[model samples]
Target: MKRIWKQVQQTLRILGAGILAILVLVSSTVPGGERLEQVRAYTRGVEFDYAGWMLAALWDKGQQWALSAPRYWDEKTQRQVVEDWAALTREVQALRAESARIFADPSVSDPQTAAAPVLARLRAREAEQARLGALSEEILQIQTRAVLAEMGLTYGKQAVPSVLYRISKLPLALVVSPREVIRQDANISLLPDMGLDEITALEQRVEQELGVSALVVQIGGVAVYPAMVMETTNLVYLTDTVAHEWTHNYLTLRPLGMLYDASPELRSMNETAASLAGKEIGLRVLERYYPDLVPPPPAP
Candidate 1:
């Protein structure tokens, strides 16, 4: 009887040690699982803050300039663009507020105590925004010059026509097209010096093979996709698209993404920041080259 009791105690002791070992392994691995989420959140916070500031500053400057210029644009179109700008500004402010709340949350831990590294990342994004903005401005100036030359030939004076921008949508994809002054049916056949039918067929086949719901396509510098947002071919637009997509990639690496499965509000905040940044950088380009084409002021 005593021998049997001793054997039972030994078995229980072994089981207890096994349980303890498992607990230790889990504790060590669990923190790592959450680390990625924390980092993604941190990066997003930085992006939102910087983007909001840039856009607000750009809009203020642009609006003031527009107000001082002669009335060149149609009243309806001008009002519409001004309204869009106001809406975008509101969105940026909301994103900034949300980002601040996330940063302040103690539950979301940032292991990196030093703010220096974070600041460096922000600066890099800013520099990238500046470079892309310059490129966009250069392209706009070229287009504007072309418009002026055409006007001179026909009317002996420059006339600013309506500028219209659009994005075409396809399943699971986006395409950015160039800005057009007059609306017309897109000439799919002449796009990109490639066979339009063949490319469309290929895209369909690829989508079927990959089982994706949609694809993005660029036609004349405008982006088209089924996604909720309008797309653009502008370098600044592309930069923001790339940045937003990259945030998704970064989130996948973190614990919050894993744990939260990318909550709706989180995704909104992410996209909003990217959108704001794109517009901010895009406007900087406009200001540098098309100074006469300044964005109008928000409605009172």
Candidate 2:
């Protein structure tokens, strides 16, 4: 009887040890597998959302520009641009749909208790996507205002006299007024030598070139992070652009950012803080340097 009881206890101990080992293996593998799957799934949703918004905005703005400046943009060209944007949008949408289908499979839906870490990672990814989307929207709004301001002179009445002017012999000057003009970068030329379509192409080229150059200068050979361009033709825009760029500079120095390279939420916090700072700095710069050229904030 004593020998039988001892044997039973040993058997129980061996079973418990085997169970523990199995649990450990599963816990280690599940979280990593689940996290990769979830991130891929959520990223698809985010991509869809971003593509839809961008396409819609582009279509709306292009249409508005076409209608407003019929003399500048012909119907065929307008339609072509719209069609191009739509095609890109559709491609992105299809990619998202395929990802969604893969993620939604029943086989993939099987969850393990060990997947908790992966689930947490997925949540973080989703949050970051949301943050980036919000920041993009904010930037788009600013760009819209800049577009309106730029177009206002031709489409509507000029609200302010031209602060930008061309000089034949001397470098181009950004004249706040007759007496208070500043000699900015000699390469800063708003005037394009091409027609509307050609000008658009040139602008894109210039933008890409300048963007790369700026990244090299500002980030010191590091890979460029995600960014959006906001127009800087007006005082409000100038302030915002300065603030936005400065924010990027700020994040490169922080420790929290070191842990996560592509977190949208962290980027948003960095951007928002920089934007606020830019606003403050811009207002002060205007007050000190171009007091006469200060413009009122656009209605929110």
Candidate 3:
């Protein structure tokens, strides 16, 4: 039993190393020129902590594996959990909107008093939402892996690197493109909750200092170990983003994905390929499981 436990630890360490290698590969894709460093300087204080996030995520994954919780839960339970989460998400959204309206209403002098009920309800739902949300993410990962396996995209009866993702508040990306032409030269991740004023200031600084077009864009997902996906109630979009980011991971091991930073053409090809494959995989998952939620075919 001691030996077996050691083997598990060894496996996890190897997996952690592999994830780190992928991060390095992605960071090296773009040339580290003066302009890139200049942009980094602006984002130095606000950059997302990939290392810390990865460590926390790996620990979470370890807990899930130890419990084997989702595997024991029958299909009915899984479906019910996902459904409850979705319903709860919609309710939370409505509560938030109402709370905003109450606070914004000029007539409501004591906005806090007016919004107390909504706030209380929101606080009450937080625990359940966290539980259901985590389970839903795990279920979707399994479903996506099953779809990939069916598509012959898996080896050794598993999707390479396995399908892993976490739905969270995603980080914002600062993309820098030369004004002379439209091409991505640098993409830096920033704090998810960074203020709009700060983002605007950074973008303006980068553009003015480097003479390049800079934009702080909201990203739905990012290719990281246990890929980062934005929190959303829309199941279809959620699944699609998961598959999309996973596709990038899939490509990372192959020549096409490895050459993603070789040239503008290669980058475009890699992205387009991931986009197409992600959509196909996402639709297949929906068709097999959430058929009712699947979008209808477009008119001819």
Residues 8-56 of candidate 3: C-alpha lDDT, one tens digit per residue:
7745863675566457654653456677787888888998887678667
TM-score of each: 0.23, 0.24, 0.89
lDDT digits (tens) for residues 45-73 of candidate 1 = 22212222223333332333233222344
CA deviation > 4 Å runs, candidate 3 = 1-31
Two-way TM-score contest, 2 vs 3, winner:
3
Query: Candidate 1: lDDT of 154?
Result: 18
Show how many residue pairs clash in every candidate, following the order shown. Answer: 31, 1, 0
Error of 3 at 157 (Å): 1.6
Model 1 deviation from native, Cα RMSD in Å: 27.6
Candidate 1, which segments miss by more than 4 Å at Cα?
Answer: 1-194, 207-212, 219-271, 281-290, 298-300
lDDT of 2 by residue, 1-300 (tens): 885565456434433433432333223211223333433332222221222322343343333322333224443443344334334434444544555555566676644433455555555554554333333233332332333344442234321211111001111111111113322111121221223564344434433543311100111111111122321224445444543443443344354333222343654565567667556655654554345656777799
**Candidate 2 ranges beyond 4 A from true positions:** 1-232, 256-262, 297-300
Q: What is the lDDT of residue 273 in candidate 1?
A: 54
